[model samples]
Target: MSKRNQKNRQKQKVNYIGGRKSFVRILEEMNEQDPNLIRFYKEVHWSRKKGCFITDTAEHNYKLMLERLDETEVNTENNNEKCNAAFKEVLGHRSGYAKELGHSVIPEPSIALHKNRDYLRIVEENERNKN
Candidate 1:
């Protein structure tokens, strides 16, 4: 094998290790034509070799693409009326906001914690009053 092919095979690392060009071609074909092929292949051929694998049927690269798409995201300028407008206009409601995991916006840890804290505080106060 040539050095370039060797390099490609090596780069396929987590999956597709020995099938680089064909691997990428499959991705393009699925994206351009039909996405169900990816799902079917993954359902049939996916492997635990990559911890990121969601199913055993998908082709290696197709699974990787799904992972990338799931984790991918969009950029926003702000979190206000203008931002909301842009989100609606450019992104639409349920289209491009989420990553593969399906969340368009990831809430900050602090925000989640604060909400949790508020809920706990309310519960504690209510319990104390009852006692």
Candidate 2:
């Protein structure tokens, strides 16, 4: 119950919170090894509550890592194309990208009506023709 541990637990918002440390171990491993750029192995335990292969925290952290990798790939100026490519390939794999709900997470649609105006227009036109 040290301050650092408490902070990480809060920051990670670990999903398998019912007396399990598996998700925390995975996060530590990722932080220590930076395995996103290389092949790595870690055993994942199922959460009885989630009924999935991984916890929500694990999935969320994986997404954060992917974003960091993308930023590194774009910002680095040392001709590190191969390094960046390796990281991207690992992220594309199921182990790195799998989610509790599914393999791919679809982004929510934009809220602005103007952005979806074309689709709305087509629907309205069809409605007019139907009458």
Candidate 3:
């Protein structure tokens, strides 16, 4: 096969943890194993026209999910590793958006900063302008 064909084949391979069924299965396992441990799982949707990610929370929870996945066993197969890869991709996209808005890094502001509604508004406005 040609190099291009080989690359296409690689892309066509099903990602074990990228699918919703497997992702939720792993999350449920984690939750059942330990209810005390906080695990935030949300379906992340991206809007091409809006040029941003949309979720229930106005905040990106990719980093937190990644951190928890690193500590916990997400699946029986090698799916845990693939899940991490998927979340990392989301984090990369989010970081790109942050950079475009002139932020040095993705804002994980302190509690005090989060409480400052004016500051958040300004930051959000900057993101919209950049988009």
TM-score of each: 0.21, 0.24, 0.22
Output the TM-score of candidate 2.
0.24
Q: Highest TM-score: give the candidate number.
A: 2
Q: What stretches of model 2 exceed 4 Å from their correct place?
A: 1-53, 74-131
Q: How much is 63 displaced in model 2, in angstroms?
A: 0.5
Question: Which regions of candidate 1 fall more than 4 Å away from where they truly are?
Answer: 17-35, 48-131
Model 3 pairs whose backbones collide: none
Q: Name the lDDT of candidate 3.
A: 0.50
Model 1 lowest lDDT segment of ten: 78-87
Q: Please, what are the lDDT tens digits per residue for candidate 3 over residues 1-131?
A: 69998888676422222345444445556656642112323332334456654543322454555564666666657554556455554443454454433212455668899779999999899999999
Candidate 1: residue 54 lDDT (0-100): 42
- Residue 67, candidate 3: Cα error in Å is 1.9
Q: Which ten residues in a row have the lowest lDDT in candidate 3?
A: 35-44
Can you give the lDDT of residue 59 in candidate 1?
38
Model 2 over residues 1-131: C-alpha lDDT tens digits? 69988888777544443245454455456647553332222134345455653656555545554555555645445424444454455445454433432223444445785468797898689999999
